[model samples]
Target: MRRLRRLLLLLTCLAIAVPPVAVYSDAVAQERVQRRTVLDLLFGGFGFGRRAQQQPNYQQRQQQHRPQTRSEKPKTKKKVPPAIAVPEPVVVAKLPDARKVLVVGDFIASGIGDGLTEAFTEMPGVAIEARTNGSSGLVRQDYYNWQTELPALIDEIKPAVVVLSLGANDRQMMTIGGSKEKFRSEAWSKEYEQRVAALSSFVLEKKVPLMWVGMPAFQTTSMTADMSAFNTIYRGTVEKTGGTFVDIWDGFVDESGKFVVTGSDINGQQVRLRGSDGVSMTKAGKRKMAFYVEKEIRRILGDAMTIGQPQGGEAVSNLVVTTPTDAADIVRTQPISLTDPALDGGTVLLGGSALDKGSGRSPRDKMIQKGEFAAAPEGRVDDFRLDKRPQPIDPQKATN
Candidate 1:
């Protein structure tokens, strides 16, 4: 009986010990699992060490503010200003004669106007001056004051070639003082013809050769027709005054008389010329415009400078960045190209070595190609933009 009691007690102790061990084993397993999960969140692309946490919110902001064209216009009044007329282009006051050139027109001329001016740096001794303000025209306006501004522009710039680029805003209804009605009837048209005649004579008197740039077609067919009428005035003025009238309307307009954004440029590459904003120039647009201007200037230069040889060069700038914190800072550098493209959608190609079916590589350390491309596996891309400028765009640059 004593042995039986002792054995029973020993069995009870063993059972108790086994239960505690099982419990401890389960606790350890749970701890290990929790640690692994935290590590995954820290190191994985799903969340990870530092910047990974903020990526989701950044992506959300991009999706929200993307080029969906939400019309959140600031409140503005509709009172048309009276001091409206095509003024002479503003110049940099003192550039060499080789650099002295004129730029003219309305808001469209002024779009990337600063950038357009910068493009003149390609020319060794060339300079660009422009004098277009808001709502200026050669003839026919809803209302404005050309009398006050145009003469000053002419006298000050005294440009070698006066680039006249207005007429988009001339298509509007306004008070006709003599006829006492809007400029639609025969009388208004007659008065309009007279005003055009006066403007032409004035430009001729200035003795500056003029380049009459016709308006590019707009989304609205009616506006296109209106621009055509205004261009007729421009053409007539140029013809009568012995000025060269380059029909850029065709440069930017389509066979349907619509605004064309696609074509092979003078550089032997297909390109688009319109911005997404409906009435502005894209980078290609700006470059193409500069190209046309360059053609004109080159022709003029041929009259004076001797051509020895053609040369090419590229400009480069680098930024060295360092922060005071973090033991091992990851350095992710993206190159940027001022003149090329990057990103098709969500994919990325940093260098020529990384381009897949949807992308082409760049040498700029900017992404020449990257993004989600469902359309062209190898065709012309549409969604390329700047990595930082606007499109989250990878630019035409190197990745490594």
Candidate 2:
């Protein structure tokens, strides 16, 4: 009994001691796992001198696994718009004895002269002489008296045609017989008409044809109305004195008769015709204004205005025929009439010859004369005789 008790006490002590040792070993292993070095975390290994090697950083690993971006693309250049092309005027040399066209009046006359120059650029027989004072008008006679100056100009230039475009600056009061008269007033109209008659009579006396160009519509309604009245006075006075009055009012206005800044040009193209001031004309406006005057000039001048020809009515021949020295050496032949059949040495016209009666007539002739169509050939698509077999219908056509 004593031996058995000793053995039991020894076994109990072993169990208690063995369990404590195992618990201590487990705790030690857990502590070792928690207390890791920086190199062990990066390399995924323990810090105990085993498997010691340099490892990749977090950023480097992320970069290695990152998706690659598209290759750098080249930048495309911007497209530039083309510059507008302006047509340069063709300059032609004038003849020494070119007929002179004398242009006179205000600054508007200067624009007309420029236009006429371009109009007759191709015609070497015509020359334009522009003599204008921008601020001069019949209303301001003392400022620049056209009555005295025009006669001298007519004698000096010896112009074939005298073109007058004025009244743009004649809206102010006029001094008549040392008395100031308002524009379009009873006294002013009489003196203005007299001045116009005097100017036209000067050109008529010189045997020079006169063309008086009237004013165009303005942006201001009052100014436009004044111009209209002035045009009326100009037309009556000019016609009475046997001078021509050029009405350019329609050219600068719309279909409704209202003033237009942009309108059809001489070439029928849409363009800016007037300046911002509304009174002044643009290059296109000047060209268009001349177009109206050009027609009258051509009509009055007649054959004298023929382009690409000499001043005199002379014919230019390209062929040169040499005549025989002796009359007997020349041979004469009878002229044949265009209606005579002998001209072509044939009686019947082309394809009009009669065919042989034995030969069968064409299907067209048979249908026309006998009202009968030729029979369709055998195995043909259009053959529809009562005894013929029916053709197979097209599958595609049936589906359609």
Candidate 3:
């Protein structure tokens, strides 16, 4: 029984030793697995570093892939000079030696005539005949067509010079080939230009010197703008046609280009330059308009020295015929081949002879004695024809 107890105790001790050895073997196997995983991580990290070092940078790759362009200097802006306006040369008539001036246009032209009359009153030799109609323009042919009437009128007057100042009423529709066109429209503008050119050409064809006066600005802004545009067209056409375009825009406008009703007169006195309506001019304003034109006339007349002097070396005479003479005799009486100064009664040629101190009281005196001639009747106060009957205007004819 003692032997059996010893063997059993020894077997129990062996079982305990075997279990500890198995536990140690398991711990070692787990340690080997952990070491293998660490080695794999370190190798993979080295491989990634090598690949990164071998790769090219983005900028380097772009440089290799993209084509290069030659370097160029930055461009600089060039300075340009402002344009200066030069005055066009004036074309003088060569044919007729008559010194008579013919004025035609709208109401403004009547004012020009009045102003010229007053200006030339001192110089009795210069004659000014004004055929201005208030309600006249290039647009309305049914009323008074300047394009047609002007040629006939020129034939009747046989003037050495012509002055035109219409367009005030021309900002209206035009009838072209029975088709009505709106003013300032492409068609209307073209047709109007053609008409203006025709007038200018007609005057030039007659070898008559022409002065085209531009319209002044109105109190109405749109009117002012239209006038400005018309002036541009006039300036270009007149210059092209060898006519002088007189600009009176600056005279009626202030420094800022606004219309001024009052301004300094030629006499240096402050006076009303424009009428109450701002579209028309006052008496002083008319005189001012004439002032600009007079300068040009003087230049054409050889600086005013030859204004009273007869052209073609003909003697100045004051002879008068008591009896009426035939056309041939009348033509013969004008020995100067220039003009019939006697047309105005101020410088009538007497007896087809040279100026002599002995002529039964000069023609001017004779007219005064006979009471046949008198100072220009005082102009009607209502110069605008407001007192006259207003003609019916076609609405279709109305424009800007």
Q: lDDT for model 2, please.
A: 0.83
Q: What residue pairs clash in candidate 2, if any at all?
A: none
Candidate 2 Cα deviation (angstroms), residue 294: 0.5
Cα lDDT tens digits for candidate 3, 6-27 = 9999999989888544445754
Alpha-carbon lDDT of model 1: 0.60
TM-score computed on alpha carbons, candidate 2: 0.59
Best prediction by lDDT: 2
Question: In candidate 2, what are the lDDT values of residues 288-378, reduced to their tens digit?
Answer: 8888787777665655555466546444211122357799997655454568867755555444674356646798898999898889998
- Model 1, 223-329: lDDT tens digits are 77777877786688668767766676666776765676676565768887676655677677766666565556555544322222134433211111224467566
lDDT of each: 0.60, 0.83, 0.76
TM per model? 0.48, 0.59, 0.52
TM-score result, candidate 1: 0.48
Between 2 and 3, whose TM-score is larger? 2
In model 2, what is the error at residue 25, expressed in angstroms? Answer: 32
Extract clashing residue pairs from model 3: 319-349, 319-350, 320-350
